[model samples]
Target: MNHTTFETPVVSRARTVERLVAGQPTSDGAGVKLTRVLTNTLQRRLDPFLMLDAFGSDNPGDYIAGFPDHPHRGFETITYMIAGRMRHRDSAGHEGLLSNGGVQWMTAGRGVIHSELPEQEEGRMEGFQLWLNLPAKDKMRDPWYRDIPSGEIPEFTRDGVQVRVIAGASHGVPGAVQRDQTEPLYLDLHLEPGARFEQTLDPALNAFVYVYRGGLSIGDTAVPVQRMALLANGGDTQGIVLQAGEQPTRALLIAGRPLNEPIAQYGPFVMNTRDQLMQAVEDFQNGKLA
Candidate 1:
């Protein structure tokens, strides 16, 4: 609910881009076209963070079918809708409409069956769905869900840059939600032409930035549109600095405390070991996953 304005933070040693990756073209949710920015391959390196999928399309045919009833366990899903509308229904009896600039945060603690279907027949459906892993002790916790309207999220503007704190604190501004296990930091940055922004981050957290509109620079690395730059981690860097070029740019900056725990994933289910995964599958098959 914070529409406050503030000055940008100072970063003494900004983290540079370790790898520049182009999102892979893929489809999910009953044929919804999207770009998989964070794939399964990087799960280990990212830890607590599992996947980040970006989807945007003007053609209704591309996203109309939406995501059918799907089972998820041992993790959380944060769907940020940039445009259009989608209805969500889950086994836990939670339902909501995610419209433009809204977020649907759901935790499939032990397990849950859900569906995300488009509420529109035409126009654009643009958004990002991020999957975050749970800690071993809390993997089987009860399911939880929350719908966050755009205005409810805490945000601040500094100069020409606007920072939306989705999950963690930014420049003394707390986000809409917080998690103790991962201490995740999710920010949506909107920068005007020639604007510069800076954020302070814990050196121990793993971090990355995905440029969705226009392009920007991180140190010497040029992050173009549709590209994700994995930030280098270490005690050497204090945070990150972002500067927009001639044109306005928008991006998602995400970081999180590493779980450093073993990750066992089998499709929709993510657990601690192979045996646990098998048990999850069995639970789903037996209609007990929810």
Candidate 2:
């Protein structure tokens, strides 16, 4: 067995972020079948992070149920396409199609109402939706949009494995979408059978790997497909490493600094206080925002 070592800032286990497991419910609407894996209530509070959902439908009937206009606040939503196409239109007057390897990163700082519809492609539609929370100081800030095409992202190859930098830093490369608050690392990796890769990370930040296309063995644990493996951080002297399995493997590695705060959430709105939640509801009802 060949071993590779990666270097990253070290910290004590006491600073490691907590991990929570959630089997997101399958909801049908707007012609799509969505499995909500993580959400505000289940994640406790947003700390440079919040939720993730996977929507997949090979049958037209399952994916045709699209999402209508919905409101969001105090966070950003990132939509990444792995298969099929998605058309997005938002209250900010932003609209576009996210094809395979495309991404839409939108900041719903104050509020925004948007709708996402599956654009049929060879009768299949599959994608991921991730939610990132902003700090209290930037929760009500101005909104912006980053429509990133696949080719525009940075990538590198190692030992027959290719890695794409979706956010943060890796292999001396960094993602384009910059944030003032949360320093996050989002990556898309593809490894050939028998390949291996390792990356360092901040010991104080929470980190995990989600297997979507293949399986991988981390440390002594074998993480299967469609499952997420939460890594142990903080106080550990050695960084993390991964070894690819028999078949080609594709996975997403994500990590971010922690945000320890009380979370008040209601449906599409997430805030720090209950009063803010009520205010968000009122805003949506009054047509002030959303």
Task: Please give each candidate's TM-score.
Answer: 0.98, 0.89
User: What are the per-residue Cα lDDT tens digits for candidate 2 across 8-96?
Assistant: 33322222223434346577455467777665554643366788888776777777758888999988888889888878898988898
lDDT scores of the candidates, listed in order: 0.92, 0.75
**Each model's backbone clash number:** 0, 14
Global fold similarity of model 2 (TM-score): 0.89
Which lDDT tens digits does candidate 1 get at residues 1-290? 76665445779899999999888899987988999999999998888799999999999999989999999999999999999999999999999999998999999999999999999999988999999999999899999999999989898887898888899889889899899979999999999988988899988999999999999999998899999999998867779999898889999999999999999999999999999999999999999966
Would you give me the overall lDDT of model 1?
0.92
Q: Which portions of model 2 miss their true places by more than 4 Å?
A: 1-22, 28-31, 39-42
What value does the lDDT take at residue 206 in candidate 1?
90
The residue pairs found clashing in candidate 1 are: none
